[model samples]
Target: RTNDAVKTKDAFRNQAARLGFGTPNLLEATEYPLTRLTQNWQLLNSLYRSHWIIRRIIDVVPGDMLKNWIKITSQMPPDALKRFDSQVR
Candidate 1:
């Protein structure tokens, strides 16, 4: 799971770099996706802490197009995508 998180973060950061958004801060960026992609869903399913995840998404993700990033990562499952959609909107 941690490996999944790292891969997701790397892919996201690389895309951001390609789009001239700059890479995510290594120290700060890892934890958010790291925790989210672990398949635990405990934090993702929460009400209050979900804010943190959303904020992280805003901070780390580049540009307005989010679905691109989701697709690029190829790490999020359908259920996770649904949760992300609801949380994002």
Candidate 2:
């Protein structure tokens, strides 16, 4: 499921590029070593704090549900959506 999500995102990015829309490269934004370290540390800390609970959730939760939850929580703003729609069309 995670793989599917990644593939979908990549496909979207590729399509956007083909349509002349520029997508921000998150990796480039975090190119500084200190920034990367901070991000990694935060991820590690979060995992350390909820390792067991996260494991249980992953073991029990359906991938589709998790994907939907992520999408709902990470919705684009109206203006962004409008821009995306215009560019996509």
Candidate 3:
């Protein structure tokens, strides 16, 4: 369990580095939820089928997670976040 978490953290760091975002700030956001959404077959099925309760979770979960991720990662040093923002332009 500990090992898996460490590996996940490393992977997220690499991913963030590639996108030129600050690594530290993205740690928590990348940990379980990101991995879970991609890897959980049951959850993915519900999301795809848009099951009633799952539909509500779909409407809120990813958007909320992404918003929180951006909020935290946007706190990068000096003008780092600005530069990252410009890249999306």
Candidate 4:
């Protein structure tokens, strides 16, 4: 699944490049800026969008949508105030 995700990302970058959208640099675990990206507002917003549109709305067949939402949200830290998993300090 991880490999499949990587391939999808690669395909997205390639397709974006082909379509004249500038391909933003891909983030990877080893990259020095990976942490910055993982904590980025834009990326987190996109993740939330995907969570809504893809995870819930599109994949309506999932048995436990709320649990799936929590699981996906908990994977990332509080990148933005809207992040589902977070604590106020």
Model 3: per-residue Cα lDDT over 1-89, one tens digit each: 36554334343336545543454444445755344456788878867686677777777877787674544344478588777766864
Q: Which pairs clash inside model 1?
A: none
- Summed backbone clashes in each candidate are 0, 0, 0, 0
lDDT per residue (tens digit) for residues 1-89 in model 4: 35544333433336544442354544422355334554687876677576766446545556555544543434454566454355521
lDDT (Cα, 0-100) at 36 in candidate 3 = 46
Q: Which residue segments of model 4 deviate by more than 4 Å?
A: 1-34, 52-89
Q: What is the lDDT of residue 43 in candidate 4?
A: 74
TM agreement with the true structure for every prediction? 0.19, 0.18, 0.28, 0.18
Number of the top lDDT candidate:
3
Candidate that scores best on TM-score:
3
Give the C-alpha lDDT of model 1: 0.57
TM-score of predicted structure 2: 0.18
Q: Look at candidate 2 and tell me the lDDT of residue 79.
A: 82
Per-model lDDT? 0.57, 0.58, 0.61, 0.51
Error of 1 at 23 (Å): 47
> Global lDDT for candidate 2?
0.58
In model 2, the worst 10-residue window by lDDT is: 4-13
Q: What stretches of model 1 exceed 4 Å from their correct place? A: 1-72
CA RMSD of all predictions: 23.7, 27.0, 23.1, 21.3
